[model samples]
Target: MAAVPLRRPLDAETVVVPVGQVFVIPERCKGCRFCIEFCPEQVLVESDRMNAKGYRYPVVADGKERACVNCGFCRLICPEFAIYTEEIR
Candidate 1:
């Protein structure tokens, strides 16, 4: 007699979704909060450190760095073109 194999159930909560990669050019940023305010995922925040121009720049928030959804709102809202996102693929 042959034995049957057992399978475990899949859980939706355990699935991991792919997010976008976010890049920030601190030197080009002018301490503007447009990116932070317009980000759909709210993944960016003002960094504690200042840039070369003595301006606070946006960075991936702690514990939420991988939350970006590849949305270009941050890039579009950035008047200085300091921030952008790439799809994770």
Candidate 2:
């Protein structure tokens, strides 16, 4: 059997990937689908939860916790102002 080598990042110590802390007001979301549809990273997905308005909200996709880039696109695009992101410094 051929052995597969595990490759690691050469500059893992110095390279910093910006992470975004995503926040969503579940009750404020009216199933607008802006955040889930327009994320440049495509990190948001449809959540199986329903809020007070009986509408599905956006949630981070499985295994994509660190995918957001803190671009503020979701907040800007959301008409309900239900979602926002803060950059993790």
Candidate 3:
């Protein structure tokens, strides 16, 4: 066989991609759907039930887990201040 070059394996010093899960507060949400529309990852979903304000709030889907950047934009848009993001690690 002809001689071939081999690629080196990745080491600890290599850059690692970061991933995290998004969390939503059903009780705190006012059902404004701000997070749902504003989320860059499109992870947020509308809940079946409404919040204290009788408005449908945004919620994170259980099955469709996504890597969140934790930008905190949802928290800022939320009038109720119900949504919050945290790092997985």
The lDDT values for all models are 0.86, 0.91, 0.72
TM-score for all models, in order of appearance: 0.76, 0.79, 0.64
lDDT of 1 by residue, 5-78 (tens): 77655775785656889899999999879888877788999999999889999999998877888868888889
Model 1 C-alpha lDDT versus the unseen true structure: 0.86
* Residue 9 displacement in candidate 1 (angstroms): 23
Range of the 10 consecutive residues with the lowest summed lDDT in candidate 3: 12-21
Models ranked on TM-score: 2, 1, 3
- The candidate that wins on TM-score is 2
lDDT value, candidate 3, whole model = 0.72
Model 2: residue 21 alpha-carbon error in angstroms: 0.6
Off by over 4 Å in 1: 1-18
Colliding pairs, model 2: none
Which regions of candidate 2 are displaced past 4 Å? 1-16
Candidate 2 C-alpha lDDT tens digits along 2-89: 8889888999999777899999988888997978988999999988989887899999999989899899999999999899999996
lDDT of 3 by residue, 1-89 (tens): 98788875678468554556566667776666778887877877887888676777776777656556676788778888778787664
